[model samples]
Target chain A: QGGVAIAECAACHGEDGIGKDVEIPNLAGQHEVYLYRQLQHFKSGKRSHKEMRFESRQLSDADMQALAHYYSQLPR
Target chain B: QGGVAIAECAACHGEDGIGKDVEIPNLAGQHEVYLYRQLQHFKSGKRSHKEMRFESRQLSDADMQALAHYYSQLPR
Candidate 1:
């Protein structure tokens, strides 16, 4: 499930979960709960990132959870 | 200047920039631009965290930059 969503994320976040740009956060080795919360914040407009908001809007709670887990386990 | 503001952050983030809780982020070695942007988001209410919003509101742009630089240099 996360692998599917990660396809989109790879554009900026990279396949290794390391962000392609300095302004983008590196998701590798991040706390799962923290990542999930940020995704929730983006979805709810509580964290404002134009692209992140749009991307997170496409995810369900489970998708977000899976994505967070997937990325959190990646090597930093 | 950043050292002064960091005293408050040390309570939760620790002197090493490691978060005390899973919900909080580990700031050590994070991208400076990313950290700065997050602080700006908190100050502007673009990223909504009750405590963070209040803390960031007290910081000037230069203060945020200093704090970002200070934390980003810490060992991960």
Candidate 2:
């Protein structure tokens, strides 16, 4: 992910994208396109969750793409 | 899973739990606990996506459990 730090994601999604909480999704090995799209939705307000929207809104397209690539590559 | 009529779910999430849109997550074979928790979150406003919130709010706890079980059993 181009060396960007995404520590915030680890709080809920865990360090490996296997989400820490049962309510959260395990992002590991999910489709990269799907990851990117969901981030876009959260950023655009098409999808709205308090924490996710806040986090995603701060992401640039590059950040979103990088995170998507990062998570999609992880083992579930 | 017990013939509770969840036709509304088939719109974004297809008949087989494979989401029709690239942005949506495929729910097939996802964790039952995870699915159930998310449905609860959507139902309770802990998470919010317009359509999801609207639909989930209409579901009873039994409906959430049934839907979760149904999706978790499908092939991803």
Candidate 3:
């Protein structure tokens, strides 16, 4: 919905946020605050994971906000 | 492989350890230590999430260890 294309995320989190089984997590239906919080955490290393941290690093605050909004709108 | 039925996990993490989508993280192909650490985190409140903490609370040390071992063995 924002500048970042959904395609990049879809590779892991699914074209929808219903990601691949187990290794990935479903982003759909999550609370926007929680999603934004985690993305911030991933970016800041408050939450530690190589891939997520790297992915989050690429996102701007606006991107995180928008993506969180995008995914939160999805059905679980 | 362990006494705990995979069915308990399959509800969310799949019959294997691959989680449903973005909200749930994949357990497959993850390191055993990482899995163990997260389970411990969830149980101990180092990580916070109602469902995960509740689920982890139901697991014993042995169960967490075994499940980590179990899920870690699955191919990504």
Candidate 4:
């Protein structure tokens, strides 16, 4: 499920959870809850990253949680 | 300089760069540029978190960069 959810994320945040660019954040080993909350914030407009907001809007609560867990487990 | 800048941060983001609470983000091994950009966003009100905004207001550009480097170097 996480692998499927993160298909789009791999473009900017690589398969290893390392970001493709300096401006992008590395998700590897980040706090799971924090990642989930940031996704929620993006969906609600509390966090203002245009692409993230659009991407997060496509996720369900379960999808977000799974994606956060998947990334948090990756080596930093 | 990074050590000095991270004094207050150690309270919430621990000395090891792991967050003390679930709501806080772990900074260990995060991309330096991304961390620096987030700090700038907090200071400029582009990102909204009450405590972070207040804390970031106290930093200069050099301080932010040093703090970013400091946390990014910690083991995740």
Point out the higher-scoring one by DockQ: 3 or 4. 4
Ranking by lDDT: 4, 1, 2, 3
What are the per-residue Cα lDDT tens digits for candidate 4 across A1-76? 7567698998899889888998888888788999999999999999999999999999999999999999889987
Docking class of 3: incorrect
lDDT of 2 by residue, A1-76 (tens): 5244378887788777777766787777677898998888788876677898999977889999999989878764
RMSD of each: 1.5, 3.7, 6.8, 1.3
- Report the TM-score of the second chain of model 3 against its true counterpart: 0.89
Flag regions of model 3 displaced more than 4 Å: B1-38, B43-76
Report how far off residue B43 is in candidate 1 (Å).
1.5
TM-score between candidate 2 and the true structure: 0.66
Tens-digit lDDT track for model 1 on B1-76? 7777999888888888878899988787778899999899889987778999999999999999999999889876
- Candidates 1 onward: DockQ, in order: 0.72, 0.37, 0.10, 0.83
Chain B superposition TM-score per model: 0.96, 0.91, 0.89, 0.95
lDDT tens string, model 3, A1-76? 4555456777788756766656566666556776788889888887777888888888888888888888778765
Cα displacement (Å) at residue A64, model 3: 0.2
Predicted candidate 4 versus true structure: per-residue lDDT over B1-76, tens digit per residue: 7566688999999988889998898888888899999999999999999999999999999999999999888876
TM-scores across all candidates? 0.91, 0.66, 0.56, 0.93
Q: Please state the interface RMSD for every predicted structure, separated by commas.
A: 1.3, 3.2, 7.4, 1.0
Q: List the residue pairs that clash in candidate 2.
A: none
